[model samples]
Target: MNQNVATSAPFLVFTDLDGSLMEHDSYSMEAAKPALAELARRGVTPIFASSKTAVEIIAVQRASAITAPFICENGAAVYDSSGKILTAFGLPRASWLDAVHQLRERLSLRFTGFSDWPAERIAELTGLSEGDAGRARSREFTEPMIWQDTQANFQLFQSEIQKLSLTTLEGGRFISIQSQFDKGYAMKWWQARHNQPRPFLVALGDGPNDVSLLAAADAAVVIKSGKSDQLDPQGPATVIRTSIPGPAGWNDGIRQILNLLDSQQLLIY
Candidate 1:
């Protein structure tokens, strides 16, 4: 939280990280620095909502010099700026991990999850540094995994997991196993805390997992991605798509939306 940023502003930007605010491969936010600076200048709080774990999200916030709170593990939990759990939507990671392990053994599933891999292997798979990979593995809830089985087997796995009261979400690079809650549930929970002047929520994301997040927002920005299954969030009254991909697209989308809101006098600061 930059001291210059005004938390009193009636606006909030909830953004995804991996392929939305950061680049897909390089994992850099260099291109979005200008937009971030503008956000700070405008006194708007940017809350991160991602599949990353608490430690990983905290590390990203530290790197970016941001102290705002975050929603982690694909809406499994919300943590304050200091990494304290504000609210949790899903069961503990161990519960989900145990169920996944049991299903894998019973169904002979062929997926490699974070709990089954070493930090080095996770680093190799995700292009993250070994240190960051370790942070990613420090999950309090949910398990992100790469599916390595046939489509039919994957469907069987999903069916079995659903029977056990678990759900799966396909992210930018991995499919995560967790409880039924999605990003929208977490966002609304966070929003409910503000009663004086409820914030105007804006969400930006670029994956199937982000669909709930986008739909939860009063405004949504769908950042372009190189992947064929580009997201089309349907609920928001204002949905803007960027032409470019990665952080550049993130930057453009933010600027465009802010300008649009300002022109329409929708921002109440």
Candidate 2:
């Protein structure tokens, strides 16, 4: 480990949690242990880019011993490794919810957002334990809602959000409404702070919410989902989908990407 020795180009790996790195239903990353170990061995950086709130992602970070900065709450914010807040770009939760409340009454939209649900109900809906649900409910920026309405009305609701200069995005379980912030925005901000030469970004996700994050990456891994929709992002990088699902797919995908890089000497110093 000589200080004068050179390394390959900096590579950052950003990933979604629930359905990409962790089991979709079981919420486990135990299957991807080998890939994680290999990436760490090669000095690769993996950051969790997720729709989960800061509190929720922090819990996962602590449990998994991942110290890299993370993108959270549908890219509402990014936090550094030490838990210092890097940015707060999303709309205020209270103000956003207040508007949604008025919109619900005015449009008669049958929407039940996280703000309306108790932690127990949230836990039941998500199959998360009660304690985990509490962390999930501590939303700081985005308001994810379950819209119980027709597709036509849902389209109309999104139109209304656009008119208000707000936004809506679909996730694994809910649709998020908030400011113009997104996963791409968060990634760009975090990348700016790195002083290294332009790094190769490797992002992975399995849901619609991760489209932007995937699109922003130099190489993207779209994990397969049987119960959810596929992610298709418009980008110039190499894109691949795992035939298998969850962390198993995650492991296969990362290893393949590394092999590709090494064969091409793509990131060699």
Best TM-score among the predictions, by candidate number: 1
For candidate 1, write residues 1-269 as lDDT tens digits.
Answer: 36332456668899999999999888999999899988888787689999999899989988888888899999989998778998898988777677689779988889888888999999998899999999998987788888989999988988888887888899988999887898988998988888767788899999999999999998999888855156777778888888888899999999998898879845543
Q: In terms of lDDT, which candidate is strongest?
A: 1
lDDT of 1 at 217: 91
* Residue-by-residue lDDT tens digits, candidate 2, 123-223: 98999999999999998888888888999988888888777778888888888988888897788787767666756788899898888898998888888
lDDT of 1 at 42: 79
What does the lDDT come to for candidate 2?
0.82
Indicate the worst ten consecutive residues by lDDT in candidate 2.
1-10
Distance from true location, Cα of 101 in model 2, Å: 0.7
Q: Name the TM-score of candidate 1.
A: 0.94
> What residue pairs are clashing in model 1?
1-67
Which stretches in model 1 have alpha-carbon errors above 4 Å? 4-7, 265-269
